[model samples]
Target: MDAHFARVLADEQDDAPTPGASAAPPASSSRAAPTAALSQQQLDALVARADAQELDQLDARSLRTLVQALERRVRSNALARAKHADAPERFLESELALHSELARWRHVAAAPAALLPELAALNAAPLLLGLFAHDNADIRLDVLALLAELTDAEDDLADADALAARRVWVRALLEHRLLPLVVTSLEQLDSAPGVEDQDEEAAGVYHALQILENVADLEPPACAQLCATTVVLRQLLRQVAAARRFSANKLYASEVLSILLQSGAAPRAHFMAGTVATGTATAPRDDSDSSKRRKQAGAGDLLDRLLQAIAPYRKRNPASEDEEELVENLVNALCSVLLLPAAQMHFRRLEGLELALRCLKDRAQYVFSGALRMLDLALMGDARNCARLVEVGGLKALFAVFMGKKKAKKPTATATATTTRRAKSEAKAKEEELTMSILSSLCALLSPAAAHDVFDRFHAKFVENDMEKLDRVVDVFVKYLGRVEQRDLAGDDDSDDDDDNDEKDENEDARYLRRLDAGLFTLQRATHVLAHLCASSRKLRAYVLVKLHEHRIDMDVLAQILKEQLAMLRGGDSDSDGDGDGDKDVTDTDGERAKMQAQRTLLVHLLSTLQAPTSDAASSAVEPKQEEAKHET
Candidate 1:
């Protein structure tokens, strides 16, 4: 009932009963009067002195009691630390106990889900979160580590109930303005890059970021709040922009930034508005260059800030794998934001197209892929960018990548698992980046040129070099179609179900997705580039037709692609008799539906243009699907 203790006795009365526990208490002592909740200090002393075996054997009610007691002890010691700020000896013992009590909360992570909600009820979040400002750095760091442990998602992944408990704790932490405090601690910690011997502070910063990530995982709104409501995004941007050397925190800051931007439009619009000063967590007054950047960051273009942050590696080589990953993360985040029209405008104004082209041409392995991705997203639906791409020889750079895939180092026969995975991953990124860059070129170039730059010059590039680019595009189309056919064939090598039919169905669905990932998406993009080319230049179409006839590729594959696209376009309403949402980004899917309507229409027209197939295989492929499409429509 008093402030010195959390009341756990009455709180547990309504909790869902623990697994295997009875619904009611024994009748032996029912006549005796109910006991009042013990004070926090008394409960702590009792729990601490109890045998370890007795503690281990605690039932649900006892576990709830222990959680409240820890909350009380932590709160009291926190107050003691604050009161004795000028007198260290007076609070030394209290700080020590406070650390122990914080560690003690880890026990609750192992308890039944029924007891976890009591943390919110006991108001433990405020007391634990407030310690980030405690004068003792170790104590503050302990809190960060403790918060990360308590909210570890792996522990809560067993089922729905376990996950619900994690959400409760995360929401409670955010409810107490935890984001602002975490940002403040990051500012205070000596986490700046190039600092020597920052092992402790680095760990603190890592734990801080890990905590933020965990909180964001359980409470999605925390990400938006970090961007718009708190200065956390500014801190993260500061970390990213301040990198002079590779640090885990800097890499982590980039990862966290990517997560925030991808989370929703709030962060995209936050930086797309070109400022980080709007967050409420204002930094303390300082005049160092870094500090000045922080101060200027409030009004500076954050996209520019991000650009400068990444600009170093544009020419300079990365010293390590971590550095490469950091660059990729920043690039990914930038691309995510560029999905917005406003961001694309800023990207164009900043000459981002030229910079991306240079990076692409640099031919640096991981960074090369990143640069290509940057161009892919930046050029989407932006004619100014496309024109610049032409002016700056961007076509030469993209076409170079399109004509030849970026190569990853091959693993040796004795390669480790890590090496093998890295090789495969790099290869995958190379394929994806090349495919997308090609798609972007075709899409932007073939569309109507900008009113301000009315030179539909994309068609001209394909015609140059004796139709070399067009020929390469046809090769890519054939290559991806072969991959799709191979994977689809693998999917059809079915076994009789020795197990449940549901498992077989699940496997079929998963195989379908793997097929899409393997080459179906790339195949679709290739189809689009070819279709757009066909529609744009008669010579380009004729060149493509000749190349296909030479490859002897079945023309029915084009018809099959059309059917697949139609399915994806109608996928959002697989069971629908109603109109679907107009937002293509949300409704479009990878499989069980078509990915691109334009690709579908182009395939239909292209197939019509090839009405007289030179082979029966091509002829038979188009006819059945064409007939089915008519019925489906």
Candidate 2:
């Protein structure tokens, strides 16, 4: 602006007014070019060009000076507004100048390191964050736009100086309460009329979400900070966990909410506890009105509201890709919270199991996978949930899906590179997920309990229809077992494969083994399911032995197969990179090996259930009554 004034002053001519005849000067003589009062559009365009040009001419020192100048203009105009409220003439012009001056900083985005440290040193974050509440919506939005660009992540950037600079800048912003201001801007723009059309291309809500995601992604600490107060969580819940009209912003909020929940257990606990504190106690949010309305309209914790939002997809699949992804985000967020026992209890209280079962039954291509994941997480180790699952008749859907056709395994020539392989890998992953989910559900349902009849209804499924359910489960176990055996027995004909397995690198060896043994987990879970059924009921135990006999699988053979699995698991541990943490990969492989050991233990106990009578296959089918009587005698 000083340069513009200087140019205007330089162009002025000191022509004497004595030439009155020429005072009118043929009505066309130009004394000097007028300083054009730029419209907001022209001003914005001018600022856009100036941003690039000015920054190009600036060195580190010059950039810092430019920031200080903009800061002065902002504060000066703000002071004018406060002092001269009745006089628009005094403040209005400076307001536009400040808006333009702020607009020029956007070019710093391309190289934010120098500018951010400078801003922190100058204490410019409060001024910048304070602009969020300015009377002019465009000014508030420009603040967001600038912040969004400045905070944009440089994913490939590894400059030590830049990282340290960003850390300081972020700290400064948070110190002045950046998040609450952002939420206010978010609600204002989201609810404000005609703000979006100011630039049909730049969506304010999208910008707000991008700002959040970029910050959270660049710094894990930011994720905790974002969720520390309930304002962010509550606003995000309002966006995702309610029946709000759908938009891309809804999907984005859902994604950020998931990150927050998964960041640490504190956020998850807060969500489950429905604790809505502001900072340490309460935050001043723009959505306070909507918050109360939401509490009234939707009762229960955040988990329950998530269920309500997610419930629609069970019967009707997402109508569009955005909606599908949105629901996926909600389900993902719910899954993260479900890791807490309190969340699981809340979920079961809300009858969330029934909803998941319905979704599994709907098998709508879009809804089934997400619902299966949520259900898988929900019933993992919770007996009450599994009991509710059984009570709600979830078993039928699990069996129906379990009985679905097995994918064909055929040898094929390796193909040229294309998307088909990626698609196949995805499909294969989904298949594994579905199989594991049902396996888990069954294991949870038929688990041992103090009351004999607790699992009798579940046990009876194996005995009804000539033991159809049990036969199918065994077939699944056999099928997965066959896959494992075929691959293991093939014995690495590929020289590369053998080399990879011999490599001490855990990742490489695991990848090689994973490709060969895709059936391992399905096999483990199937083994667990069968083991539970055998141990839970003597009548079911007799049927299991007969089925194994019919399939030519003797007790010794079953034990041998299970032992081979254990050996594979144990041997994998031996291949760990000798990180001194073990030739053990103790953290990663311990749980899996332990699970396999437990599976083997179950098989061993099942094998020991009846030692005296396996010689006659026909007589192996004995009654619970006869077995009990013998025990009594």
Candidate 3:
């Protein structure tokens, strides 16, 4: 008897495809020939016996032989009759007998390890998708648990047959007909705190993500079939929302949502977004005014929920990470909406935009860049929106960020040469580069009058004794001026060359330059505001003068300083760069120490005695003419 059982099992094992082997045939077709021979009554009898928990009572060798036979039937699909074929009661009995025995086998702690693989193979085979839809919860959970194990096995990803079998089981699990039961199971798994240990719960979450990952790979039609059920969508959203607060579970929720979005479930995403938004609006906050407290708390709660939804996306993995990167793709799509004009309007009224911006501010560098790219898209061809960015203090905030170092320092090494290392030096260079980008954005939204107001509001903060921060702010100012000058230079160069080009090319280039110049001029105006602090604020005047005198100012930046000092000297009248003639009293001191001391004296004296030029009749007379020309256009 042992020899006979060994021979049978050996043959089946030999036939088992290597982990990387070609796809196996679907189990139903392969197993159908054997199942056709059994009757329904016989199957029912086996189920009764199995449910009666009689598996261990069978002779151990006999049980092993039965398991081998059942595995062969399951893997070959011999346990199920062909579609629309007359399924005999006996064949049904045989399949049920296999299922019942496997279900009861879980009670046997000493069951052979091979028994698990055999049972898992059966569950993941094509024949059991329908069987798991059986009304018995224990049966369904047992089947699902086994299938989840198979997905983690090597053969699952490599063998098309195994993947196909698993796919069918997943479909059955998520199908509308079985959604309620599956949802209940998911809910229990999620809510029952101690039912699963940390590792098991983590595995369960990973399993759920894997299922979504698999479903996402299917065609749109197949995806629609799975996602079309409202119950499935709502359940997924609720699970994700609830899971978002738990940092450990957040990644799983993120994975699921990513799959849903990538599967072309746009409405579902929008629906989830709406729920997140509404929830944020109604959540309560900690406050003394009961009404205000309720409102803020509700908003805070809602915001926390949204943060979870978006947090996983706050970091980027490389492009080769997955077939469909749900996190990156969803973030891209949602950013489009959030940065829209309509959304921006609401963003100001609620915490959504603020949260998004904060994430951009504090998140991984690539994420920050991506978020800014989205903002760039929102502002493109929309000058008013660009202006609105300035109104919300975006310029100052972005300038501060641009000057921040990319790599953080170790606290213990702060006092060493670590602060002055080459990495820090290079980072400073990069900081200047990013500072210009922020300036470019602000320049596109030029409002000379508003720039002045913004500068005054931040003047005190900018003039504080923190030299590092002050220098960073100054660096941003210089870069802003550079952007403006570059635009001006580009415009002049284009004008001279436009006549030599074809009319169409000339027109296009001319338009581009105009757009660029507008942006640059906006930056120019903002710099002018900062320049005002050089004379209008006494402490700032002294600080700037000291910096000006110091040898630390790079030569490339001296030109902007010269322009600013000239403007201050001229009583706030804007000075064109060409006016830097040798006639001015300005003198370059050669020694670094002497120059620094001289600059300090110059700035302090200038601030103390500075005065705005009177509005002479000639200048007052020209204002209306410029206004008239602007209005005419």
Candidate 4:
């Protein structure tokens, strides 16, 4: 191949004359060239030779010639296929041949900039889009493949000029109204009979979706163009609704919906209003009246639909990994929507908390993690949700998961060790996260006025006569705080170890740090819950203080934890941070900081209340003063 390329370059060089003699070919040669244009037979032979092995030997000019020829053949073949449209098989065969030639063109025309002009000259966007209406599904699929190649962003191109040229070509394709057509084609293919007869429909949908995703990823103008074509959003939502559990179409549709929703192109009111009528194939209504209606309905409707979509998977085991992921995504969508006030109201109305509670029992960690997060959001500041949660026995359920005893205990003797230690580590991390979420939910519930009765009920169940449950709660706080204290005492010794530590030791240290962080979070939440209880109910405070004194629970530990947290908030040394563990920004660090401040404030209030005189003590002193006054009289 190298020799052939060299020989061709040499022949061109030999035909060239010195610059002073002539810059152009001789007039006699030019006249003969026009008359000696290749015949159809000669063109076929040339294409066959290039297709076999000579394509790589072509120079830039020869490559352009080959690409142009292939483009012309594609056009001619499409025309021929249309002419024989009555013979479906023959049309398909010709379409396949056309796609093969285009694929070859894409291969040899490695410089995308070189072939783009030829494609533009052929009006390739419309030509390819036109095939989408063909009766043969295979032909439509082939057209999609070609279009994907043509519109693909040339990321492999290193030169700025080439990349800009590719972008311009893409913009041209978009300008030619390719997005609307792609949407329309997907809608048609989705409704086509026997779409499942082959993989053609799926392939076409995948490519169509890819094109839309790519367009959406372009500059704001291109995204606007895509968003303006409202049919795509409507179709995508319908596809998402119709897709079976764990289907690829469902996953892609969800992803596209997320992108669209996040783009700020689709009005949140529209999604919130539940305006997407299921199975409706019409274009989206984006007018002021529609927006007004969406506002009137609010996000409640959307929250309802999301809840319904995810409700079925609440307790059921997923059939596959994909199904689990789909469930998690749906739950996440639910959580995102629940951020709205209206959605939170509707969530309680729709029994969303119950669904979340059921999901908390799911074997898939992601599914339950999402549920835990949603519960956290729903209970954040919504008193009505807290009341509903208590009504549904959510408090007990949370305690069950928090204590890891909802299901029967498995004795350690019967446990089997696994080879994958990482899996075990991950499981433990998830368990900690779950515990953290449960504590967060409890804290949220404890903060609301409506939750006072719920707290009373919890106290009656766990703290009334049985000190065991109460002690357990106290134990969680002390256990983590003690760990922090121990780590702090050993900090100086570990400083030298940190420098000499191997990778495995470093990893172990990191894990220990993470565990320490989780512990501090847990301790903070425990303190918050205790503070709330003490501030809300005097009798509860008296009972807790008595228990603390009886059990010799170190009030100093609570003070120490508060001091460390306060120091961290003030940007103190790493050694003075929570549990004396170094601080790194984790996802919930900001939230944790805020919670710690609130906990500190609450702790101050509780300590003041505990030390202040009780009503009985004041009344007793007043009685003695009154008797003394009577004796003096």
TM-score, structure 1 vs. true: 0.71
Using all chains and alpha carbons, the TM-scores for the candidates as numbered come to 0.71, 0.73, 0.41, 0.60
Clashing pairs in 2: 22-25, 278-281, 278-282, 278-283
How many pairs of residues collide in each model?
A: 5, 4, 28, 0
Candidate 2 contains a number of clashing pairs equal to 4
TM-score comparison, 2 vs 4, better candidate: 2
- What tens-digit string does per-residue lDDT give for candidate 1 at 379-408? 765656666666666666666666664445
Model 4, range 186-244, lDDT digits (tens) per residue?
Answer: 88888977654546577778888877766665543454456555555556666656234
Best candidate per TM-score, number?
A: 2
- Across 477-566, the per-residue lDDT of candidate 2 in tens digits comes to 777777776775554443344445446366545544764455766766666666656655556667788888887876555555556556
Q: What global local distance difference test value does model 4 have? A: 0.55
Give the worst 10-residue stretch by lDDT in candidate 3.
624-633
Query: Which ranges of candidate 2 are over 4 A from the true structure?
Result: 1-51, 112-115, 154-168, 187-202, 275-300, 405-454, 485-502, 505-517, 537-633
lDDT of each: 0.63, 0.62, 0.44, 0.55
The residue ranges of model 4 lying beyond 4 angstroms of the native Cα positions read 1-49, 52-101, 105-139, 146-181, 211-237, 240-246, 254-270, 273-305, 361-369, 408-416, 419-432, 435-442, 445-455, 458-469, 479-520, 538-633
TM-score attained by model 3: 0.41
lDDT of 4 at 317: 53
Candidate 2 similarity to native, TM-score: 0.73
